[model samples]
Target: MGQLSRLAGTVRPGGRTARVRAAVLEATQDELVEHGFHGLTMDQVAARAGVGKTTVYRRWGSRAGLVVDLMNELANQSMPHADTGGIEGDLRANALSVLGALTDGRLGATFQAVVAAATCDEQAAEALRAFHLRRLEEWVGVVDLAVKRGELPEGTHAAEMIRAISAPLYYRLVVTREPVTPAVAERSVVRTLAAARAGAFVEPVE
Candidate 1:
């Protein structure tokens, strides 16, 4: 989703500008992990980043802008779709990737803070929405490959297949407040592939 990039009012830059963005976003995440969205402030980020407050305000405009760019940066840094030569292996890799991210201390805390903020803040909600959508789009390619290889139903919904693999893990992490163990991630892959083989993810003709 390019919505957040548009909201930030700039495309990716280079040289000094890129450095400034990197510093400011790092500061933003540090603040989010320690103080959360409510406690985050433009002035504090500027100070933490060692940049001028005016520069921070001019570049990002608001706390939401900083978060938008940070999420974009993370998305850019995320691993691409796995190619393990089969649907099962690829989906297993996807599940493990989700597990790693959710279990990572700093990254997990950053996401939790944003998810909490999204409930009450429209801008934060947009950032969170954009982040997940970008990830989903990137991972959909693996499903496409599986279909071409006849490993899945011809009309299977690729995005749905990807979502199914992660949804249970997220439910455990955010809803049930239970541990999202590797076993849980493995179960998701096994179950989703079974359902997929049974045509559970096929799209209906309107």
Candidate 2:
């Protein structure tokens, strides 16, 4: 991991830094949702976080930098994947957990804001991509276990299967503007699992 520089004397120890960081992230989320990427300003974050503008600027170099930090924080706080001792149960749990998060008004809105910003900002795009890659790796681990247990075919590409399961939920969020309900998640898991079981996701022989 790269060394992260602290805001020299700006963030006090003993949870002060954590508290302030949380406040700043919450304020950033609010600003992104309300004013969008272009309108995100240090002044707005400072006002919302109840901190000095210099404090915000000193800690995060720019609005994009602040957003990158906020994205990292959100990804870190996401729920851990389920391990139910079975492939189907684990997948169902995983899907529902993600669906629940997507349905959360705050998280959902925040995600949309970031997605919008990523479209126009290279730094935001890199951060978003990194976040997705981390999520993909987590989901793939569960599928790998399933393949080892013969629940899925040997050589099944876990990452591809996981993406197949999640793509629809994201589509609903970004395109259809529809709610990503538990039912939707359940169906996605069921369909993807069915396809995997049918060898649709198995790696082709050379």
Candidate 3:
């Protein structure tokens, strides 16, 4: 992994540095939504951001770098894990949040572009995997709280529980080519919660 990709999440920005990053990311997202990943170009992002091409190249290194940083920004902007004092409520919150992101015109388009790129590009695949993993890791805490509260099995895999809550929705959105709506999101929450409560997500002893 490149240094920028490894440190994308930890690097803090401020003042002029923050402004440049914000501009570049905005431009990157716009290009992605408008033209898809294959159409995206570092020069175009630079032009859109009103920054020099050399600066963009020197800073971002490549289109994949821009994408990783943009995804990092989105993950940072996503709301923190919900704590509704109950497992069902927390899972519902997670589902609704996923629905909102998938339904948002701009954000949804950007994700679709990245998904498409991932089909043929290894770097894009890595970027997508890392982005979704971050999201999963963030929300898995809710499941941890659920387990602690005895709403789930003591050994439930929190990450898989989190993944379960969103997998059906994404399948509908990206696989079955169906609408990803509030109804779909709610269904995912219910089904996953049932399976989770049944110990389906419990880790098997080795």
Candidate 4:
């Protein structure tokens, strides 16, 4: 699966520890995509990974612990903010990246599983929160650069602007159950950019 490769951390020759971690994470993602978080179990993950149950438990402690590490790995692999010499292009690039991940079969299912789990699981929710927070921080750089270039307001909240670009796409993906297409992603960037240019994202002076 395309998602499996992304979840598999980099490997090194003779790196047994890295290999074990990669196997466990790959198995964890496969289980999440097929069975979801509610159905996920440490034993199943261990069995699927071909690692000992004791090794799984000793390393992850519990299903939530596994999810936390998995989320962190995914976050670390996220692409850095695009710089296309203009905010619009960068925002469109960002929006399309979100659309691509949410539309991907295995990756999308994995995220949906985590999101559903987060609805009632505090640990899952925290993991999801941290994952998005890291992504948001990474992409906010484009907005900050745009402001410095006089393309956006002087005090535009970079993080807020970046969030605005992705919010509508996510709403369609999770809330409205609507199709998240390239057109939709483009519209989000356009609307968010227009608002940012109008100072809608500017932080209020206290």
Candidate 5:
């Protein structure tokens, strides 16, 4: 849910279109959480949203399409990347945000469903890639700010650094099937920040 919200595009302040999109997206999340991606269907979402099946199919095309659009809506609702002046503080904030989303029951399940779908479905993989790319683009600004302030090396790969901060948490949440707690988030911060501050994220010369 959070992942989708964070990936969604901008919405007009208020309108029939906006209301419909919100309803459809909310239904999409509910379906994803309860049924996983495999169990999600256009008819189910349409019924849940109280929208016509034709409208759902015409607007979103397929289940994967619905997931992608839901992600875009979610993205649009996400707050801008954190800005704490100090790079360490900013990175911690980023980690906390990811942690919050992963630990959230509905959002976490949605992400897990998508992650599993991506393993077998090309469309799902593409949707996941597109959504995460947008999120990384939004967040790398913090690292860029750090570099400009001399907190990080000039050639630091900001997006990669941000990815590093989130990787372990996801791994724990999805791979090892371990608990994703505040302690895990904090460890990710310390580990990623230490390596980043040591220039591990600096881009190599071409």
Candidate 6:
């Protein structure tokens, strides 16, 4: 099996253990946001979590391991897509949800900083990719529903449509350094839905 499979298998199953793991992961995310990846230390995480260094080390093994777990936890906690009964309404809800996440006072700056650091760190990049994949899966469900409802063209790539909806928001957050307001998110969803309706994402014949 692959590394991820192995990691999945190793995750502790149950109540108290799961709670402790979650607490530690939350502490790690806060530390990483306050002090970049390079500056983050296991000792600091233990201190913030009110746990001992030995507990953290025994549980996670290293800083990278802790970060990987944190990313996985975040992915698991990501909001699910809304089924609003129409492509436009679904996309609108989806876009607004993303905007809310990006602009959330506690998670926004942390996510932005982590994404920037991921560009230079292989481990961070992998974790970030996993988080995005989870998010894409959520959005794809909405697109799939639209296809079933005859709102989208046949063979439309829901994953690609999700990327289109999010691209501008990420660009604004990372490049343009602008706020990901509801207006911006609504416009993106409208444009992407319009294009998808127009067959902009139709797959070419093999």
- In order, the Cα lDDT scores of the candidates are 0.84, 0.79, 0.83, 0.86, 0.83, 0.77
In angstroms, give how far residue 35 of model 3 lies from its true place: 0.4
Listed per model in order, the count of residue pairs whose N, CA or C atoms clash below 3 Å is 0, 0, 0, 0, 14, 0
TM-score of each model, paired residue for residue: 0.91, 0.88, 0.91, 0.95, 0.91, 0.88
Worst 10 residues of 4 by lDDT: 1-10
Query: How well does candidate 5 score on lDDT at residue 93?
Result: 85
Model 2 over residues 107-161: C-alpha lDDT tens digits? Answer: 6776787888899999999888887787777678889999888899999999898
Which lDDT tens digits does candidate 1 get at residues 17-110?
8778877888898899899989999999999989999999998999988888888787777778888899899999999998888877777778
The candidate, 3 or 5, that scores higher on TM-score is 5
lDDT (Cα, tens digit) per residue for candidate 5, span 1-206: 13333222444577777767877888898999999999999999999989999988999999989888866666666557887889888888888888888887878888898898899888888888887888888899989998899888889998899899999999998899999988888888899888988889999997
Candidate 1 runs further than 4 Å off: 1-14
Best by lDDT: 4
lDDT of 6 by residue, 32-146 (tens): 7678777789999899877889999998887878877777876666667787778898888878777877777556666776787688877778888888888887678888888
Candidate 2: residue pairs that collide: none
**Regions of candidate 3 where Cα sits further than 4 Å from its true position:** 1-13
Candidate number that wins on TM-score, 4 or 6: 4
What are the RMSDs of all candidates, in order?
Answer: 4.6, 5.2, 4.9, 2.1, 2.7, 5.6
Candidate scoring better on lDDT of 5 and 6: 5
